[model samples]
Target: MAPQTSETEQVVDLNSWLPITASRKAKWWYSAFHNVTAMVGAGVLGLPFALSQLGWIPGIVAILGSWLITFYTLWQLVELHEAVPGKRFDRYPELGEHAFGPKLGYWIVMPQQTCVQVASTIVYSVTGGKSLKNYSMVAFIASTIRGSHHHPATYGVRSHTTAGQIFDVLNGIGTIAFAYAGHSVVLEIQATIPSTQKNTSKKPMWKGCVVAYIIVALCYLAVSISGFWAFGNVFAMPVFDMLESCLVQKLHFTPGRALRFAGRSTYVAITGFIALCIPFFGGLLGFFGGLVFASTSYFTPCIIWLVLKKPNRWSFHWIASWISIIIGVLIAVLAPIGGIRQIIISAKTYKFFS
Candidate 1:
C-alpha cells in the first residue's frame, strides 16, 4: 500500500476540492439573473392577488419587509466575502465555518440552506403552473372571441375551474421547478469568479447588489400594481391579473380590432412563452443538485477539512449534480403537483424569519 498522506496534504486537497470551478464562472450573468428572477418571479406574478387580499398598505408593507430582509442577507454575504478575501459567497457554509466554529457553522447554515432550496423550488413550480394556466385561459378567451361567427375550432381548452386544492398543488410544483432552475444558476456564478489572494474593494460588488435590489423592487411593485388593478378583488395569480389588465384596452391605431385575430395571436404567443418555460423545470432540478453540492458535498466536507486540516480527493462537487437530479425526480414523482405547491408557499413565509 502507498504511504499515508500527511494531514497537511489532506487540508490542501480539501481546499482544492472546494475551489470555485469553471462552469460556475462562465455563466455568471445567467446566475445573477436567476437570483433576481427567483426572488421576484412568483412574488410579482401573484402580487396583485396578494395585494387585493391584504390591501395596498399591507401589500406595500410586506414588500418593504421583503426588501429589508433581502438587503440584510445580501449585506451579510458581502461582509463574509470581505472577511475571507479568496472565498466565494456562494460557499456560505465555509464562511460560517470560518467565523463561527465548524460545528456551529454547519449546524446553523446547512439546515437553513436546505430549507431555502426546498422552499424556493416549491414556490417556483407552483407559480409557474398557475402562470401557464392563466395564459392558457387568456388564449382560450381570445380564441372564442375571434372565432365566434366563423370556424370554431374545438381546442377543448377550458378556463381553470379546478378546486382550490388542485390549484394550490399545481402552483406549488411550478414554484419548486422555478427555484430549482434558479439554484443551478447560482452554482454557475460561484464557479466563475476568480478566487483572489487578497481582499478586494467592496465598491463594485456593492454597486451591483444595489442595482439588483432596485430593479427587483421596481419589478415587484409594477407587477403588484398591474395585478391588483386587473383582478380587482379576485385572488388570482399576478400573471392572471396582468393578462386581465392587458385585455381591457384596445389598440390606439386600430379601434375596430379590439378583440381581433391579432389580439388572439398575441395571447397565444404569451401562452407559448409560458409553455416554453417547461424546460426550466429541468433547470430547476439541476439547481437543486447544486444545492445538494453546497450542503452535503461542499458544506459538510469543508467542515471536515477545517478540523482535519487535510484535503481528500473525494469532493462534494463531483456527486452534487447527480444527487440534485435524483431528489428532483423523486419529488416530481412522489409529491404530486399539490404537495409541491404547499411546500413552496409555506417556504415563502420563511422569508419573514430569514
Candidate 2:
C-alpha cells in the first residue's frame, strides 16, 4: 500500500494542472507573440476611425502618448511582479491586494479587470462576426449592398451636429484608451515565464514587450494614416481561455476536460448572442475603453504604484503619475458619455443580427 501525505504536506503543482498556467517554459519570442496579440489585435484597426474623430494632432498625440505612457506603466507593472524578493504576484488582483488592503484592493481591481476582459470579449464577438459576414458575402452581393458608387471614404469627422462632434471626440479618447490597454495582462503573461533569483521574468518580458511596442507603433501609424477602418472583444479571447482553465484546474473545482469544453462553449454562445444583439463593436469600443480600460491601463497602476512604492513627492515620477491619473479620470468620465450617445445613434438605425 502507498503511504499518503498529510494535507499540510500536500503541495500541489499549479503549473502541472492548469491549462493557462501549466506551461511556464515559454521563451522570449513567445512573450513577443502574446504581447503583439494583446496590443495589436482588433484595436489597431479602430485607430484610423478614432483618428478621424480626433483629427490629425490630438489623434497623433493620443497614439504616440499612449505608446510612451503605457510602456512606462508596463515597466512599473513588471517591476512590481516580483517586488517582494521571494514572492510573485501572478495576477492583477494579487498585485492590487498587496498594494491596497486585501478586501479593498480585490474590490477595486477585480471589477475593472473583469469588465475589461468580459467587455473585450463581447466587443470582439461583434467584430469577428462582422468580419466573417463581410467576407462570406459574394462580391456582387457586397457591392450591391454597399452601392456601386458610395461616397469615397474621407478622413474628416463624420459628426454633423455640435453634440455629435463632442461625442465623437469622447469616443475617440475611449478608442485610444482601449487600443493601448495591454497592461491588464502583463503580470499574467509574465507569470508564464519561469523565473529564478539570478534571472527574473521581467528581463525577458520587457524584451518581448519592447519588440511588440515597436511593431505596434509601426502598425498604428500606418493604420491611422490610411482611410478610416475597423472590435475588439476578440483580443480578449486569450483572457477568456485562461479564465476557464484557471477556474477548473487551480481552483480544483471539478477539473476535467469536460468542464473546460462545456464552460468555453457556453461562453462562446453567450458572447455571440450578445454580439448579434448589439453588433455595434465600433461604437462600443469607446464605452469599453473608457468604462474599464482606462482604469486598468492608465490610473489603476499609477494608484497602485504610489501606494506600494511611495515614490518621492513632487518628483518627476510623482508628477507623471498624477498626470496619468487625471487623464484616466477624464477618459472614464467623458468616454462613456460619448459612447452611450454613439450607441443611441446607432440603435436608432440598427437591426438585430444585421
lDDT per residue (tens digit) for residues 1-354 in model 2: 999866534324433555546667878888888887777755665776788788778888988988887887888898899998878887788899999889998789878887887777777778777774332123224434444345344446767778778989999889888888788788888888999888888899889989988887877776665434320003454455456646754776665687767777888788778888997776788888898998889889888889988999999889988988898889988898888887887898889888
State each candidate's clash count.
36, 4
Listed per candidate, the RMSD to the true structure in angstroms reads 19.1, 5.0
Cα deviation at 185, candidate 2, in Å, is 1.1
TM-score, one value per model: 0.46, 0.86
Worst 10 residues of 2 by lDDT: 226-235
Global lDDT of each model?
0.41, 0.76
Q: Highest TM-score: which candidate? A: 2
